[model samples]
Target: MARKASTRRRPRSGSSYRRVKKRSCYFCDSKISYVDYKDITLLRRYISDARAKIRGRRSTGNCQRHQNAVARAVKNAREMALLPYTNQ
Candidate 1:
C-alpha cells in the first residue's frame, strides 16, 4: 500500500495572515434613508453582550462607507446612553 502524504502544515509564528473579504453596506446598498440611534433592533447586531464596540470592515465585513455610518450611529447611541461605551 502507498503511504498517504502529510495533510497538515504548521504555520510559522511570523507568517502574514490572510486578508478577509469586504462586504458592502446593507443600508447604503438598500438605499435606506435613515439610521435611527434609538433603533435597538438595528443596533443590537453591532453591539456585543458586554456592550463592546463592533469591529469595522477588517473584522465585521462592512464596507468603508457603511462602517463609517455604523461608527457614527454607535457614537450617537453612546452619547444618548442607548449603547454602552464599554463592556460592563
Candidate 2:
C-alpha cells in the first residue's frame, strides 16, 4: 500500500505590516471650517517637529485648497509668535 503525502500550510515571511484605512482631513471631516492662525493649539498638530515646518498635504491628508489654507494660517501664526518659525 502507498502512503499519502501530508498537507501542511506554509507561513508567511518578511514584513508583517498591516494596511491602515485612509484617513480623512480633520478640517474637512469636522466641517467646512476656516483655519485660524490664532488657534495655536490646533495649528501645532499640523507643524512638523525639529524644523517646525508646516506638514504637507500627503501627510496631513488634506486637499490642495485646504493645504494652502493651512500653510497661510501657519505662516500667520508664526509671524505673530503664536508658533515658532523653526523648532529650537
Candidate 3:
C-alpha cells in the first residue's frame, strides 16, 4: 500500500550557513549613478582572489544592469593597467 504524506510542520535543518541573507547590489544601495573604471580600490572588491577575474553576478549580488556596468568597468580598468588581467 502507498503511504500518505504527513501534514505536520517540520523545522528546517539547524545549519547556520544555510540561514544566510540575500545580498543587495552595492552600487544600487549606495545610489552610485555611475561606475568609474579608475576606481581601483572599489573595483578590487568585485574581483576574485584566486583567478583575479571579475566576480559573477551571483557571488557579487549584483543585478543585471549593475553587473553589466561592473563588467565594462573591469574591462576598462584592465585596459588602463589599473587592474591586472591575471594573477602571476
* Error in Å for residue 4 of model 3: 13
Clashing residue pairs in candidate 2 (N, C-alpha, C atoms within 3 angstroms): none
Candidate 2 has its poorest 10 consecutive residues by lDDT at 11-20
In order of appearance, the predictions have TM-scores of 0.59, 0.73, 0.78
The alpha-carbon RMSD values of the candidates against the true structure, listed in the order shown, are: 8.7, 8.0, 4.1
Residue range 1-88, candidate 1, lDDT tens digits = 9999989997655548565457666777788667778887787677667648676566656666777777788889989998888876
Best by lDDT: 3
Clashes of 2: 0
lDDT of 2 by residue, 3-78 (tens): 8887886665567855556668888888967998998888888999989988887788888888899999999888
TM-score of candidate 3 relative to the true fold: 0.78
Ranking by lDDT: 3, 2, 1
Candidate 3 C-alpha lDDT tens digits along 1-88: 9999999987687674366677899999999989999999999999998789889988999989999998999999999999998997
Q: Which stretches of candidate 1 lie over 4 Å from their true place?
A: 1-22
